[model samples]
Target chain A: MQFTCAKEDLLTAIGTVNRAASKMQKTILECILFSCGETGITLRATDIALSIKTEMNAQVEQTGDAAIPAKLLYEIIGRFPESDVTFKSVGENSMEISCLNSKVVLQQMDADEFPIFPALEDKEQIKLPQCVLRTMINQTLFAAAVNEDKPILTGLLFDIEPGSLTVVALDGYRMAVRRQAAISDIARKCVIPSRTLREVSRIISDTEENVKISISGNMALFEAGNTEIYTRLLEGEYINYKNLLPADCATSVKVETNMLKDSLERASILAREGNNNVVKFEISEKNLEITSNSEMGNIDEQIPVITEGKDLVIAFNAKYVLDVLKNVEESEVLMQYNTGVSPCVVKQENSDAYEYLILPVQLREE
Target chain B: MQFTCAKEDLLTAIGTVNRAASKMQKTILECILFSCGETGITLRATDIALSIKTEMNAQVEQTGDAAIPAKLLYEIIGRFPESDVTFKSVGENSMEISCLNSKVVLQQMDADEFPIFPALEDKEQIKLPQCVLRTMINQTLFAAAVNEDKPILTGLLFDIEPGSLTVVALDGYRMAVRRQAAISDIARKCVIPSRTLREVSRIISDTEENVKISISGNMALFEAGNTEIYTRLLEGEYINYKNLLPADCATSVKVETNMLKDSLERASILAREGNNNVVKFEISEKNLEITSNSEMGNIDEQIPVITEGKDLVIAFNAKYVLDVLKNVEESEVLMQYNTGVSPCVVKQENSDAYEYLILPVQLREE
Candidate 1:
């Protein structure tokens, strides 16, 4: 294949797709297959788990395919002269790249060795504004399980209806769920891997354009401006997170998000030394007190808050509270607790919007 | 000890000294001992390999001593309000810190359990400009051995005479040595651990004022401004780097530092796939050509330069050459080489101020 394209466009596309390429992998999986034709040149990469296919318009003189090492190709293309770069396949396993006065001959692998990506059928597709989905993913994905020990927890549950879309993630320790007005009429639910959500968020530009998403059985496809991202779904049932959240909380308090976050972070340093990074929160009629103690020492912080109901004392992993506070959108966050042993719920003061539920750690007797 | 000091000052002092604390030791060697009295507060830490002591002027109420985890103390103190913070020993193993409306009591190790650092004895000391020593250390220390397999190579060699000072470091593969005009009349030689040199560089500010450096039997002490750094000297002799550098070379070429660096960096992406990241440089009367090839591909870059010798082709580890070029001072660098297998010498074009010798890697047969 022979074609010429802008250096920056190719660099970005290659970099985005190469993220899934394993550095230690010695096979063709580390190679990004490039196809050039009269229309344009397309770059594809997959580890048999997730695949990214990107097409960039280029001046095509010949049609061919070559698989180049993802990392080397990206680096070389990034460093090439800030002008149009021409690529031409010279032999079965080599391609010539020329730009300005510099030329490089890159070794290539057989494109046929690359795994065949399933064609995304034009079935049930949901269209959503990029920014809305991006925000929802960012707000809840952090609570997803990082390891596959409990495979279902590693995926975020996407529950969609006619008017609203809800995304929930839980690692058994903490759960985050966010709801947004739906832009599509389709009603469906699927568990998309947290990693796929993160990658989709990263690859999607800040443009206001809509991203078209399609789910077929166990595979999902996301199509944006010029990029297509495909990820496989986890085959398991997600836990009923709503059942875990307390229906009636004994005490609830509204405090400034930033102030509460700062106080909790300072106490976390002490709390982190213990078995579970436990920190105690004592809520009174008009004040919220946070405390943590270890063999190193103890920290006590008090923040003025508007509170209702009886006084209560609860202990939890300080990190969990900080994470919830960090993602809260409103200036004031409302914290609700039933008993010391039950899960505590945190959300923006008066909205049924985004909510976080965190299990408390039993306080150790002094 | 009881005292109140600005949170910023306390945090800075703790951070500087915390570099000396090691987590490997079972004893609370990772803790920084704080002594607060009526005059000021002193923070000190040591792992027996290196020691750092810093004094911060504070409002002292009563004298007290406590050993707190260096990292935790720094983190906690850093988060305290920018205003003055109060410190009071709550009991034998805990200290209370109050700033703004925040109060934290840190558990401390017994002061008696902390290591007793050796006194900075008034010995034969050499005074040198802080920037000069700092630059020399940065230039050569990157070449020091990281593994303990070669003990002596892990330290930076200090060679001093009546009016000159030279620092050298090598990891058997590549060596760098920097020389400066000494401001002191004393002549001495010692080997300080590379890690200690790095820490001292971080703490020492760039100042025109001379820093007093004293060498004892097995310790090196550096006192500058308000900080005192002590490092244990490595036992055994350093390699004679002068012998490794060739006195006479068959070919020599001068090239702009940045031009060569950029070209080498571009070639590095291709070279990285090779066994040793070997990049070949062919110097002729008109140009400097850099090339690297692996199973992945090959890259050739031609940079214009002025040469005074016959055409020659030499190959060396691209990373080594990049490291040497990165630290050279002059705008133009002079490269001298005899053959493809011989060591390549790199230095400033017109001066013998700093020299680098990088062993060439043997070229694989095509």
Candidate 2:
């Protein structure tokens, strides 16, 4: 087999597919199937749970195939200067790569042992701009449960309706919900692994270009530009999170996003030393008082805010509050509290595109 | 005690002395002795082997001392916004820090238990531009022995003459020597620990400002601007590296520093897979051919060069050669070779500011 391609183009393709190949695998699963056809060169890698396939333009000399170690090939191509690199099969299990005055012969695995990329039939499809999809994933993915205690909570639920899509993720402590307008004929829902969503977000360009997502029986496919990602849908039903959001609150406050984030970040410095990382917030007339204490030190900070209704005092894990505040891009955010021990709900001041529910820690009086 | 100062100034002073305080220590050594008097605020930390003291201007309301944890103070000050910060002793073991609307009361160790800074007598002194001293240390420190197999070899030798100061470091395989002109009243020699030199290099400004270096019986003092660094000298005789340089060579090759560096970096990718990163070089009349092979792959690269005298082939540890190439800022470098087994001498093409001798690895015929 022989083909020539630009180093940059090949490197990008390898990088996208290598992410899947680098995961813990057995035998030939760790290699990427590199093949050249009449159209161009195609690279595919899979670790049984997740798979990626990408294609790039290349000048095909002879059509052939080989399974190359994904990471080694990526590293080698990255080091090459910006120039055209040519790959030619040498023997039964060797491939020769040459670029400029440099030449390398790399060992290759048998292409016959590599798994085939699964062909998918779109049972339901939804299309949205890459930028919108990226925002939805980034804002909600952080709340996904990292441990497998519930199995289903480890994945983000992608709920699709006739004209809207909402992504939701919740650990036991916090939940994030993002809603975007996307048109689809059939209503469907699927839980995608957090790892797959993260990689998809990284691979998709943050531009106005649209990415088409197709969901089938137990697999979901993401197609954008010349790359395709196929991942296994998590099994089991996700928790019903709609009933958990508080409908009304006795106290409401509006504050600048950056001001709250910065104060919480400082308060977390001391709170991080303790097991619970609890920071107390005393919301009153026109100011929010935040305080945290540990064995080593204690910190007290105050930021101005507009408050309505009755005053409230609550405590929460600083990390959860900080995470939501950081993900929120609005200049001003509105927070609602029903009681000291009830979960607090934060939303954008003027828009309802995103909502966050954070459970408060039970504060013990000293 | 009460004092107020700009957060930036306080942060910088704490950062400088905090390096020495962060090292593993016992009791109060882990804390920085923060004191305010007529000379402003003085901060000192010691790990017995190395110590640092620095001073910054502050509004001294009342003169007093407290031992503050180095890392904690640094982190807290770094998080505060740019503003005036005030510190006051709340009680016997607590220091209250206030900045803007943030207040923190940090636990402190007893100040009386902290060790006092040592007094040093300048038996011999040398003053040179901070930039020159920084360059001398940077150009040679990489060759210092990392292990304590030979206690003295782990430190860089400071050979101070009446008009020149030469810094040399060598492991068993390679040696780096840097020399610069500096006037000294009396000739002196001392082996400074690599850790001390590294910290000194980091603290010194890379400018034309002069730094006064004082060498006493057992400790060396480096005073630059408002910072003072005191370190214990390694006690032993340094290796005699002057005689180790090859007097002449049978072959000489001049190549672009970046071109050779890039070629070797690519070759090293394959060479690194083996137990020893040995890359072979064939110096002919017009080209330098480099090659390396391992179980995974083999790379062959060639770069044009001007070679005078007999042709030669040699092999070396790619890391040593790459280290020197990365350090040398010259566009072109001159490499002299005596034989395949003899040490290769690398120097600046037109200047004698730095010299590197790398021992060649024995090339066994396959």
Candidate 3:
């Protein structure tokens, strides 16, 4: 499209939609369409599953459109001198980008060849504060299954009710949940891929503005400030994680989060050398003992804590315990579990806003 | 080793010898030997061809020694709590590292199994400022061939005369040399692998002290501050690079180093898309036109300059020009060439400290 914009403006616009650009080889679909008109310049990219559209104000001399290779244009523009950059539609399927004393003629695909983006209906739109959404995504996305063997496990379930919202993600080994108050009157639930939520969190870092959420059919849309991201919602029922959490425990201990995390991390040094990577936790009055043994070495460390009920000992994958402890913001975390066989419950002290469940690893009999 | 030292002190010593630790699997040689005496604690690691030894002050509880996995010990020391860290020779093939409330039992190999580093003779030694040696290494190392097809091409030749020292590296395509006046009486020459020089530069950053150089047989030692690096000299004589450089050229032009570099980098964007990555330069009067054409696109950009002799057009790999220009510290660079087929010479104004020779690519007959 024929448009003149500041080097920084176009660069920012390109970055906003760059994540959705498909990296698939040998297809025109791996391009970002630039549409310039009275509404400035609109940039759109889609990889079928994920799509993003962003707009920037530009001085449009002629109304036109051009589909340019996303990554190539980004690198070219990143190296161009800062000032007013001019983009002009030139000889068939080519565009000229001129800035300062340099001009780049980039080969482009036909704009008409770009696939049409879906227009989601705004039936029941929900708005959430960017900071809250950002925190929830970061806190829960890590627990999602990285492998696509179970598609539902790769997504975070967003359960929104009249006055509350709970975000949950679970792999077979562990689960992470974050709860926050909601202002929306409507009740709806959606399973959004963790990848989509990750992209949302990154965009949230750009601004503090609230994100407007809307959905139509099986697609979910998130509009954060000037950028909008669309992701296909996962079908099928998500696993019922609430029922999986242990409701009763024979023992519970309040330990400093940082201290516990450090002990686990140290134990991991030896545990990681072994495939099992299991760290044993033995609790008594006023202290918790963390230990690990592997071919490389063994670790035995004690951390001060306040224990309630009967003392107990448990063992778990060092990585699983470290993950939850590292995420806990408070100084103390309440760990609850029933004997060594039950899953352990880890939560911030005096607050139910966040919870992490880690299954205990069976310690080999000596 | 039975010694107690601050966490940071032991950490820094480990870092100094880290590069020499062998990465090959299933070898007890992939460890660092900790030798303690009335003097201090010395840590040493050798990968057969390269070795580093560093000493740090510590409280010698008892004079003893142990060999621990280099990387694992470094990580353990890095994560240890801040305080005096104690190391003790414990059970057979194991050591206990304790600090604050934590203790690590690391499996170790016998210190006797670690190879003894060579004690270089003091015959005809040379000393140069660390900054000077660092600069010389960085300026010429990039021209060395990465592949060992012709092992000699991967080493930098260090030639020393009465008061002059020259460092040169060539990989057939290009050559880089740095010549400086010597501060020592001894005159000797050696060919050092680029990998060794790179490690020496890294250690130089840790201290501004001058480096003492000593060579014995096939081994060269570089002692900077408390750290010493020993490298096996590349055997079988280095090439005579002085005779390869042309003494005279038909044309020489003065151009701003930054201006020429920027032009080359931009042209590289398109040139890199082609098989040859060649950028053509046409110089006439005070103008230098840089152009490149590839399957993806083409670039035609002009940068102003001061030219002399016949008007000329030459093509060369844009990467080579960019490499030398990026290394040049002066504002202006002298570009000399005899003809389109001859090698081009790039040098800083009024200095023999550095010289770069880049062979031109034969321009494709349009």
Best by TM-score: 2
Model 2, stretches more than 4 Å misplaced?
A23-26, B23-26
Tens-digit per-residue lDDT, B223-281, candidate 1: 98888998889999777777887889888898889888877888888778755688888
**Per-residue C-alpha lDDT of model 3 across residues B259-292, encoded as one tens digit per residue:** 7887778788888875478999998878888888
lDDT tens string, model 3, A1-366? Answer: 588999999999998898888887446677889988886988999998889999899999899888888887887788777789999888787788887667778888878888889788755677778998898888888899999999999999998877778999999999998998866787988899887898888877534567877877899999887888999999999988789877787888999888888778888888888547888999998999988887778778989989888888789998888888777678888999888888998987777899899888887787
State candidate 1's DockQ: 0.68
Instruction: Indicate whether candidate 1 or candidate 3 has the larger DockQ.
Output: 1
Candidate 3 error regions (>4 Å): B206-208
> Per-residue lDDT tens digits of candidate 1, residues A142-254?
89998879999988999877777899999988999898876677898899988789889998877779888888878999899889999998888888777877779788888
The numbered model that scores best in lDDT is: 2
Scoring model 3 with DockQ, what do you get? Answer: 0.63
Please tell me how candidate 1 rates in CAPRI terms: medium
Residue-by-residue lDDT tens digits, candidate 2, B1-366: 789999999999998999898544336888999988965999898888899999999999999999988887888899999999999999769999999989999999889988878788755899899999999999999999999899899999999998889999999999999989986866888999999999999999989998888999989999999889999999987778899988888999999999999889988888998638999999999999999999888999989999999999999999999999999988999999999999999998767788899999999888
Q: What are the lDDT figures for the candidates, one per model?
A: 0.85, 0.91, 0.85
How many clashing residue pairs, candidate 1?
3
TM-score of chain A of 1: 0.95
Docking class of 2: high
